[model samples]
Target: MEKKKVKNIFVEGPISAAFIGESIAKHSSNTNIGAHSIFLGQVRSDVLGENVVQSIEYTTYADMALEKMAEIREEIFAKHALTCMHIHHSLGIISAGEICLFVFTSSKRRRAAVDACTEVVERIKNELPVWGKEIFADKTHQWKENTL
Candidate 1:
């Protein structure tokens, strides 16, 4: 069987609540899905010395990131009985408390939904070619390091 390619997951600026809501609402017609797991990655304000992070400017090598995400998606589908999955990441500046990443997974069983969502999130953190610049309240910026 032929495999599907992963679509681009980048969204400009911060992801809005309305978009996320609509995404969930659209899944109402999928009767086969019994459970859904969603993960929202929000920017955090971190204090370093006298400066506090106000926002994060995200950048990525889009082509490479998408290819990597596609690999992850295929692996997850093979390993888990997921009905569907969606991944969205933000580009540009996202303020603290704003959503930067949205990962949603649905499955016929709750365990598959939860496990697929968690694994996708972890893989993206470890594998994607995404970078962040932390913009501090003092106007200084520093490169971010992925902790996970």
Candidate 2:
């Protein structure tokens, strides 16, 4: 049996627009792909009492995260007719309004791509060992919790 290679999905700081554009552009030549679904997660400034969120510092257990991601990739591919899938998540400090997560999925049909993308995002949020520290404008911080 052939071993699957684990992909590194972590990107330092925030995800840039240019990087996302480049990633999309790279798939233009693949004629077999008929549909593409993309999801971008951004940091939002939420008011908690008197303090307002200014940024989020993200951290993860890299090795474990990658292992879990690889399993997810395999499962998603097995369940969906996906031609390609890409996931990128931010590490370090990401300011409000900055992109933190990017997920792209391509398939021969729209439904497969869309479903796979949504499932991958949900799994990442629910299963991954990534954590985020919400930093307030007043310099106070609190651990962030994942919400559906």
Question: Highest lDDT, which number?
Answer: 2
lDDT of 1 at 86: 95
Model 1, range 1-148, lDDT digits (tens) per residue? Answer: 5666869999999999999999999999999999999999999999998999999999999988998888899999999999999999999999999999999999998999999999999999999999999999878899998763
Worst 10 residues of 2 by lDDT: 1-10
Q: Each model's TM-score?
A: 0.95, 0.96
lDDT, candidate 1, residue 23?
98
Give candidate 2 misplaced runs (Cα > 4 Å). 1-3
Question: How many residue-pair clashes does candidate 2 contain?
Answer: 0
Q: What is the lDDT of residue 146 in candidate 2?
A: 89
lDDT of 1 at 20: 98
Please, what is the whole-model Cα lDDT of each candidate in the order they appear? 0.95, 0.96
Candidate 2 achieves a global lDDT of 0.96
Question: Which candidate has the highest TM-score of all?
Answer: 2
User: For each predicted model, how many residue pairs clash, with residues at least 3 apart or on different chains?
Assistant: 0, 0
- Residue 113 error, candidate 2, Å: 0.4
TM-score of 2: 0.96
